[model samples]
Target: MRIAFPSTEKLGLDSPVYAHFGSAPYFVIVDADGGDVETVENKDLHHLHGNCQPLRALGGISVDAVVVGGIGRGALTKLNQEGIVAYRAVEGSVSENLALIKNDGLPRFNIDQTCQGHGRNGECIH
Candidate 1:
């Protein structure tokens, strides 16, 4: 499976996962079965609206799924439409979160719960 995780850095799987998909400087693409990983910059994505563009950007990569800390309802819906399952991963570095997703497929992506308490921190809201 080709899994893409929004990240701030390109230092392998240990890169930090970004809170918002759009603002993520680059996306870390991992070929789970092949164990190959690479980073792709999001210059083509317009993330300010927090809408479907990031999902579209991901679609271009042919990613099978997206694992992230949180995503808005609109983005989530679009991702689902594109056949990409959304997994809610919270409070972990990039590698750890991706490993969790690989070990357990489609874990409960509770956007509401994981995105809570984050509003105060000025991060993206679900």
Candidate 2:
């Protein structure tokens, strides 16, 4: 199976997951058994929500699972509707996060929780 982890930098295993423009995509594709890794730039479709196309963008890839810091309910619903497992409360670099996910499995992301609307550091609240 192919696993995808969102990250900040392309190098390292724990680079942290942050959005560049409402689209914080730092996906790392890895083999389930050997852990072989390949990196892919996730399409930033946050700006193209005019017709709800982000889901299509994500679906373009062969990702089975996604690890992200935080996401809104709308996005979460879309992911779930598409049969993609969404992991929340995640933070770290692409490589390190992948290792953590590979070894620890999916962590509790608190999907029901909402942020109080903070700026910058709290921009991902939802």
Q: Model 1, 15-99: lDDT tens per residue?
A: 8877866556788888888988988887636645544475556547888877877766666667777788778766667678877
The collision pairs in model 2 are 13-95, 13-96, 14-93, 14-96, 15-92, 15-93, 16-92, 16-93, 19-24
* Residue 115 lDDT in candidate 2: 31
Which residue pairs show backbone clashes in model 1? none
Flag regions of model 2 displaced more than 4 Å: 12-15, 19-22, 45-54, 108-111, 114-118
Task: Give all candidate RMSDs, comma-separated.
Answer: 3.0, 3.7
Residue-level lDDT of model 2, residues 20-101, one tens digit each, is 2135445555566676776556566445432333345444676666666665555566666767776653444666556566
Total clashes for model 1? 0
Candidate 2 steric clashes: 9
Per-model CA lDDT versus the true structure: 0.71, 0.55
For candidate 1, the 10 contiguous residues with the lowest summed lDDT are 109-118
